[model samples]
Target: MTTTPASPDSTMEAIGQAVIEGRAGDIATARQKLLDIWSTTGATGDPLHRCSLAHYMADLYEDPAQALAWDIRALDAADSLTDQRVQEHHTALQVAGFYPSLHLNLADNYRRLGSFEAATEHINAAHEHAPNLPQDAYGALLRTAIEQVSEAITQRNTAKRASAPGHPA
Candidate 1:
């Protein structure tokens, strides 16, 4: 018996699942697969495909700088999408509707890089766009994550300011 190969969409989905569900030991392989998909798709691939690939790729990096680069790419890909393209991909969410989560991820990435100002900007963008998001499991989780990250960023910035010279304790 022989099995047919998975389509690019299925393959990408599988890679995304592995990255989301896999343990730390599994990341290297998942990252390589995601990279292979990205090489095939390039910048001109389906906007949804590029967005998904870039979004997952961001999580595979250990370095915040590298992750930020991928996050920016993901946001760009998302911005390039049209409502028709979003429907074509059957993503169950509109193109504009992805901004909140994308912005949230950007905020997290900026916070990781110690750019609190940039992080705060993205956090505000995320909150502004969040109401358009679908009421799905992932949407709820992203909302919760955004709230937690926003609070963490605020706390960190406060601590940093308090530690600075000549600042009142």
Candidate 2:
């Protein structure tokens, strides 16, 4: 019997298991594990892997700035990604589906940082990209979050969103 090596994405997903499971006690360890992989993958690694790692890494940070940095990294990676790469890793995924959530996260982070103008820009981008989202639960969630983040920016509220990941929902 032979065992095939785990693919990079499988390894990446394994490292993020703690965050995905919401294992409250293992978050710090998960962060370090993901960082280890990030160090290996570097900025020029596979875009899908970088995007997934950075996106998951963002959720582990309670600090808005820290999360914003990771989110920005994720978006940058997404910029280099193509639908073909996404499908190779995840057949259900399309590149267009990635933008709304990415922009929404940026908007939320900018709003939290009190950068209302930047937040507004991102939120509008999210809204504009929303039609690309599939009419599914994930899409619905992002749409709702986009609206919520947009409203928070309008109100000039810097408070963390209740629905935000790692926000002690």
Candidate 3:
């Protein structure tokens, strides 16, 4: 028995339309259809489709954590495929040997999760990696500097609390 392969573009378009129409059930169905096609047919999958699906999952899925997971998956999809504009693909890609924007994302995620030390670490990495005016839109260097400065501020406050020994004010 033979099965027909799905048209990746068509499936993506349907998913996009479903999202646009606010058909939550249909959108989920279409997204799952694409996932099934990608998993079974080995399609590279459309980065934009994954991004849109991620947004849909984030906005409509009723779970903040799941939404974040979908967002990360979207980023993963974007990273997996490549074109002439590699910079447009993933912020984590290194250019001139630095990726401050990616690090900043990492820092912010960590900060939100209350991992201040890890956040500070990545923020400092962003500063060290960027260290100068960035020429590209990523602003990797500038992002790193900003996050590093913010991490420093957090560190100072933490140290103050430690010295006080009774209050964290």
Candidate 4:
């Protein structure tokens, strides 16, 4: 018997896993594959699928500016998803539950670019919604990451002030 082709959702999940697992070498190739899927889905694809594609796409970039763009797109796609649509993929989709992590990532992206204010803003947003996240390993990880980033920003700003002229060390 011939094997059946994978469904779009399955294909998207596979691609997302590959990216998360950090497949060695030629990340561009993997990103291109994601782009192909994205092209097929366009703006009207399953919101969860679009969000996943954009979220993973953000990680593939070395430049903070580029990554931030993808992050924004991912957030937008997530926001566009309706409660009914979310329920459709709820078993496989936690887009609503992922807001904290998404904001944390966006904060990190902004911090890397030395945009401390924006980073702090996103970090606050992450903290605001973090309590809603399930108390699972992934949720714990995101919470820890948010705290780490927040501390880093605080230290960086303090150091910057200390080094400025007329400021006490």
**Sequence-dependent TM-score of model 1:** 0.78
Cα lDDT for residue 118, candidate 4? 92
Provide the global lDDT of candidate 2 against the true structure. 0.84
TM-score, every prediction: 0.78, 0.90, 0.38, 0.77
Q: Candidate 2 at residue 155, lDDT?
A: 92
**Model 2 over residues 40-125: C-alpha lDDT tens digits?**
89999989888988888888888889999999999999999998887776566788888998999899989999999999999999
Every model: Cα RMSD to truth: 8.6, 4.6, 12.1, 8.8
Clashes of each: 0, 0, 2, 0
The C-alpha stretches of model 1 lying farther than 4 A from their native spots are 1-25, 157-169
Kindly list the per-residue Cα lDDT of model 4 for residues 68-138, writing each as its tens digit: 89888888888887655555544444456778878877887787779999989998999998886777776
TM-score order, best first, reads 2, 1, 4, 3
Worst 10 residues of 4 by lDDT: 158-167
In order, candidate lDDTs are 0.73, 0.84, 0.47, 0.71
Candidate 3 lands at a TM-score of 0.38
**True-structure Cα RMSD, model 2:** 4.6
- Ranked candidates, highest lDDT first: 2, 1, 4, 3
Indicate the worst ten consecutive residues by lDDT in candidate 1: 158-167
lDDT of 1 by residue, 41-90 (tens): 89888777888888878777666688789889899999888877656545
Among these predictions, the greatest lDDT belongs to: 2
Give the worst 10-residue stretch by lDDT in candidate 3. 158-167
Query: In terms of TM-score, which candidate is stronger, 2 or 3?
Result: 2
Model 4: how far is 26 from its true place, Å? 4.3
Candidate 3 segments exceeding 4 Å error: 1-98, 131-133, 136-145, 148-169
